[model samples]
Target: GEEVAQTPKHLVRGEGQKAKLYCAPIKGHSYVFWYQQVLKNEFKFLISFQNENVFDETGMPKERFSAKCLPNSPCSLEIQATKLEDSAVYFCASSQSGNTEAFFGQGTRLTVV
Candidate 1:
């Protein structure tokens, strides 16, 4: 079975500052995904990557959010110019395909003021 790992269970930042979250998908996984859970319920897809290439990022928040999948570096999500509404739990996941269930990491909670 595959799993995902993330660190810094919480983050706090002032407005206009930057926030970064980290994730490591289980070994052998080929696809990685980043999601934002603002409501603490439904997961909002942010971006996904296969190998080193981005598969899709249609759900990303324009201008403030960005993600990357670095070679041997796992994955990361960054938020620049944080806002009060940016408080949420960020989750990383890995899956073989969209049809399959994804393995989620222990989420990183971010709070901005």
Candidate 2:
């Protein structure tokens, strides 16, 4: 069984500052996804990649938010300018494909002060 991994489990930044989140997809899994959780009951998919190529990005912001899943490297999700409203838990997930069940990492809790 494969599992997703994220770094900097918690992050705090001033409003208007930059915030970056790193994720290492599970070994052997090709699909990588990112999600933002603003509330306990809400999970918003941000973007997804299949083997270093973007597969779907329907929920991602056109600006500020960017992500990459390059080969041989840990995937990355960055917010160019963090706002107070951006304070939330960011989760990274991995799966074999879109149809497969996803395995999520312990979310990265980001706080914009």
Candidate 3:
């Protein structure tokens, strides 16, 4: 079972502060993706990367959100200058891209003041 795991299932940060989240992908995985779910309803893809390079980041916020996929260190999402609108559940997922389904983490629910 290759499932992603995220920490701090919930997070709270005041405006202008920083928010950091962690994600542990299934062992032996090489591709990781990050997404933001607003209102716990809809999902918005933020970024995707294979290995340590940026694959795509079409839906990411231009002001403050960044992600990385490192070797066995677990992917991470860092958001600077938090805002009320930034409150949402951040999901991390990984897949082998062959016969495996994309596995998602429980997500980190971030709340901003």
Clashing pairs in 1: none
The reply for model 1, stretches above 4 Å from the true place, is none
Error of 1 at 49 (Å): 0.6
Candidate 2 runs further than 4 Å off: none
lDDT of 1 by residue, 1-113 (tens): 35688978999899999999999888878888898899758789899999778999999987999888889896889999999988999999988765588889989999887
- Expressed as tens digits, the lDDT of each residue in 49-94 for candidate 3 is 8777888889888689888877758788999999999999998998
The candidate 3 region of ten consecutive residues with least summed lDDT is: 94-103
Candidate 2, 7-75: lDDT as tens digits: 889999999899989999888888999999996749998999989999999999868899998889999
Task: Give each model's clash number.
Answer: 0, 0, 0
lDDT of 2: 0.90
TM-score of candidate 3 against the unseen true structure:
0.91
Compared with the true structure, the alpha-carbon lDDT of candidate 3 equals 0.86
- Order the candidates by lDDT, highest first — what do you get? 2, 1, 3
Poorest stretch of ten by lDDT in candidate 1: 94-103
Model 1 residue-pair collision total? 0
